[model samples]
Target: MTRKLEGQITIITGGARGIGRGIAKRLAADGAQVIIWDIRPEYFDSVAAGFEPIDTMAVDVADPESVATAAQTVLTTYGAPSIVVNNAGINGPVVPVTDYDFETWRRVIQVNLDSVFLVSRAFVPAMVEKSYGRIVTVASIAGKEGVPGIAAYASAKAGAIGFTKSLAKELVTSGVTVNAVAPVMVETELLEQMTAEHIAASKAKIPMQRLLGIEELAAVVAFAASPECSCTTGFVFDASGGRATY
Candidate 1:
């Protein structure tokens, strides 16, 4: 009777709530020691309540120094993480690219795209040295189809997907795996970024004709972040409800 991720050290960013929290719960339930990294400390109390042996760190994943400090703490406290999930992201305001606020666009890219780069770069070397790791990033279908209004969000996720592929190749022979999950409209707090009309239109385009459930998404991510995910790297697994898969 062995759990798949027993004793593995896992880091889950944006794990305080929503999809990230779901992934943390799944990993912890499977015997992994979970560390939740997020921008808000308040959510940590609520997040820590549902699980045992889970710790939280207030981290600004978009900042290099913050990520570096957190990385050091992780290395010192529990050694290198065996699994890293770059799941923190934001869906910026739904607005046409032509009229989108410049600063907002940059902020979106920094958080959604740059944070993945910063967080992974900080811990990947350690993972390589250990010669065992799983990196799962959350991209979006908007990245594939350029979902009109949310150009910044789409562009950042596209960068995330590309980053995952390139990083996967870099560590392909290092016994580390990197993959991205491209999800369609997911039912989470992130949806608040969209208008009612936007949400409805997005849902209409899904082949499943509905938003993806958080638990369902968590299952796919958990599989991608496990030791059992031995043969897949540099690939994007589709969780878009058939919205777009190639």
Candidate 2:
């Protein structure tokens, strides 16, 4: 059988590393033209080296102008992407809401919540015109449930879920699908910020008692961004290792 996304163009935000990197590589391996949009230019060369045939660009998803410029450059260069994965995010400082630094909270919301808005606003217009597109935002189980500390991160991700649902409904008649992926604590660079006790405790909550692998998460993402995903929209595919049972 032929590859599912052969010849399709996909733009992945924060594709330099972690789950985003896995999604990019998996999509490319499945024959999509992958464009990685990451803020750290220094990492591009290295990330590009890992995915030999993929493309890269510096994009600050939190900034509307930056996102617009990057989308334009991609369209001018590779045409409008059929698939967009809003996977950029950050785990803000771990603290109670009352003790949280306002700056850190704002930054978390900006990167996690505002960036999704910027990227979608900048690029979805073309998708709308074409009447075809796939949008998958990386959310978290924390979004569905309130976790102590990391108030901004959790709230932003929750907002992303809502955004996906609302947009999916709006575009239902069109050929566009919007969805989200909600994973539990995966063993990624982001986990380094959590205290050892917290990490262990979090792990204990999962019935599987293990952290999800990037490849595992990538598989879920690949399906959502594929043409095969026609029937599902505004849904959250869970990769929580049984940690989140809703």
Candidate 3:
């Protein structure tokens, strides 16, 4: 069988584990040279061993300098990537906007929103020069509908959706496509970190009454990253398992 991503170079942020890791594995399996960027370097040994000379880099995506440095390193090693998955994110504290800590909100916005800007700023020129690229940002249902307690997370994801649409418009003439995938809730390690009450409440909101699987979401990521995604720019693909009505 022919690989869908043959000869494509892909970069995935927050790729050490969870949703990002799932995307990295899926893209690699589909024949893209995958770069896994995350803050943890220890998981690199195990994760890297699973693919063909998988590359790993440690960077906090929220920092512009860090993102630029990592992008440079990846470019030097693998040339300009044709595909990028802006998947790095943080689920900030569960609190109402008024009760939320300012510092925590800033951190969440920095990671989830600023990181996309930093990554796009650092790498989009190359994509433009090459005259071809695909960018898929991992957004969330919180972006579309306001969640009760995850104010920071919801705000940041909404920002990501806005950024994705804006960038898609800017790159419309070029042979580059930009889109975002918004998933409701996935059964990932990040969800485990949430308080049991928060998790229960989140599950209760989903019509499916269960968390989505990593592979299920990866399928959406894979499609948005495909070359066949010619006419679908500046769009949001909802994988909410019936949680999204709009």
Per-residue lDDT tens digits of candidate 3, residues 107-198?
99999999999998788999999999999999999999978899889999999999999999999999999999999888987876688988
The reply for model 2, stretches above 4 Å from the true place, is: 45-50
- Judged by lDDT relative to the true structure, which candidate is superior, 2 or 3? 3
TM-score of each: 0.96, 0.95, 0.95
State the lDDT of candidate 1 residue by residue for 1-246, as single tens digits.
567999999999998888888888888878889999999845755534468545789999999999999999999989999999999988888988789999999999999999999999989989999999999998988887888888999999999999999999989999999998988888977777679999999999898888999888888888999888999999888888878858
lDDT minimum window of 10 residues, candidate 3 = 44-53
- Against the correct fold, how does model 3 do in TM-score? 0.95
Q: Write the per-residue lDDT of candidate 2 for residues 1-246, one digit (tens) a residue.
A: 668899888999998887888888888888888888999744654544456545778888998889989989988888878999999999887789999989888899999989988887777888988988999999988899878877898999999999999989988978989999999888887888888877887788789989888889999999999999999999999999987778
Best by TM-score: 1
- Of 1 and 3, the candidate ranking higher by TM-score: 1
Q: List the lowest-lDDT window of 10 residues for candidate 1.
A: 44-53
Global lDDT for candidate 1? 0.89
Per model, state how many residue pairs clash: 0, 0, 0
